[model samples]
Target: VYNISKEDGANICQWEYWGGNGQKFILEPVKEIEGDVNADGALSVIDVILLQKWLLAVPDAELTDWKAADLCEDNIINVFDLHLLKRMLLEQ
Candidate 1:
């Protein structure tokens, strides 16, 4: 837990670009597919278990396809991502 000293909010910034001169934005390739953490061509309890294990720093529990596991697209695997995975599994 954390205690706040005084301020209860923070500021955010946004940027807009009107035009560019022959410049392009390149996107990094995503993982093989979404939610196939173990690369078994499917999403199952084992996939969730493997992802959880990876997050827990379990040896050899590495995610075969991290892009798929990073369902939130935040470039990180966290509890929120875990929740997304669960929702997907439930929906199936």
Candidate 2:
């Protein structure tokens, strides 16, 4: 659990539990790695395989970050993206 200071530069005398948006702090944006469909913080054959399974409509197939798999920068997720993912893996 994390509690934020009530005001900037104020001496925090006491801490309290998070009070939803009223006390929540802005979180740093997470940088998503391209081709990392599983959001494992790294790109590898596992990501490629996950994207492939998602495209093939395999049961229980899920993409943690579909946008990361969009290597082509196109709105569609198809064989082209899969090819690009594989190429990226080969390059790495």
Candidate 3:
């Protein structure tokens, strides 16, 4: 599953795609669009907060793609990442 669907959690599980000819295509694992942590189809301050909460374990917070959250590309998500994300938001 390369492209995630709009339905919440729709792309976050195994799926079976049925073809018109009665063919079945099975895909494993969840597919998350990069930078769409909340999966709302856009990067926003909410995403930043979600990452923050996830790092702090503030309950019910989550990050679907650590790769996307690692803004600095340092293989870690920390306050530094938050700063980078903020900077990116500002630049955009």
Candidate 4:
């Protein structure tokens, strides 16, 4: 299979799997889902919970993609985003 080299400026070539991070990669573009704060490829209650925890400053709580939580497109995550996310979830 084709493998990507870890060394900078190295060329990609056929290589056996060594179970490294560079061994595999996505060739297609990934579409980010709005409100998918946890970035598990879907919007759900779990994402809401994560966002909530992150906003409340819960230790160790992290958002996979903070931009996804910016429902207002204002480059900020806040109560407004949470409100909109809840509304979107309810609509779905």
Candidate 5:
């Protein structure tokens, strides 16, 4: 079972039955990828491809966690984020 609450006093409760066909869940904090601007687990050519897609305005719900990609901590993910990621990778 899981309960989600918002700051406005609204809440939602949901439960999953214990069965092979039932849903499963894994909870974890968003990781700080060393230089993966696209947050796909690693900094690689794939990350660059994903970033290019995002820059072209692709609709990706997974990339909504801007904090993981906002490498500069400027509160917005754009070319600057990519630059920061590049810098981090170069430093390594």
Candidate 6:
């Protein structure tokens, strides 16, 4: 299990890997934002805006991994993230 954060520079937030036991790995939920695309601690239009900018070539910090934005697990954050965000907004 993993927790995603939206605060700037927040890394990993929390991650629990399988321990080889029957117990499921659990991580503390991120109360600030759920499904923050850019992990900036809030699920707002800003997250979608940032993702658009990043897709358009805004360079991320050297240590930032692109996987953080790959919301659909498609190995890229493009139209997939956009669609996902749209769906989320509709649900909200």
Best prediction by lDDT: 4
lDDT of 5: 0.61
> lDDT tens string, model 6, 1-92?
12334445544423355553323434587553444755666567766666677667777622133455566877766778767876775687
Each model's lDDT comes to: 0.75, 0.83, 0.70, 0.87, 0.61, 0.58
Clashing pairs in 1: none
Please report, as a residue range, the 10-residue window in candidate 1 with the lowest summed lDDT: 1-10
Q: Which order, best to worst by lDDT?
A: 4, 2, 1, 3, 5, 6
TM-scores vs. true structure, each candidate: 0.63, 0.72, 0.59, 0.73, 0.49, 0.48
How much RMSD separates candidate 2 from the native structure? 7.0
Q: Kindly list the per-residue Cα lDDT of model 1 for residues 7-42, writing each as its tens digit.
A: 334232233544442223444774465788888888
**C-alpha RMSD between model 1 and the true structure:** 16.0
- Among all windows of 10 consecutive residues in model 2, the one with the lowest summed lDDT is 1-10
The true-versus-predicted C-alpha distance at residue 69 of model 1, in Å, is 0.7
Tens digit of per-residue lDDT, candidate 2, span 10-30? 454335654554455566798
Q: Write the per-residue lDDT of candidate 4 for residues 1-92, one digit (tens) a residue.
A: 23445555566776676887766665668899999998999999998899899999999999989999999999989999999999999999
Displacement of the residue 38 alpha carbon in candidate 2, Å? 0.4
RMSD of 4: 7.5
RMSD of 3: 7.0
The window of 10 residues in a row where model 6 has the poorest summed lDDT is 1-10
| TM-score (C-alpha, index-matched) for candidate 2 | 0.72
Model 1, position 4: C-alpha lDDT score: 16
Q: How many pairs of residues collide in each model?
A: 0, 0, 0, 0, 0, 5
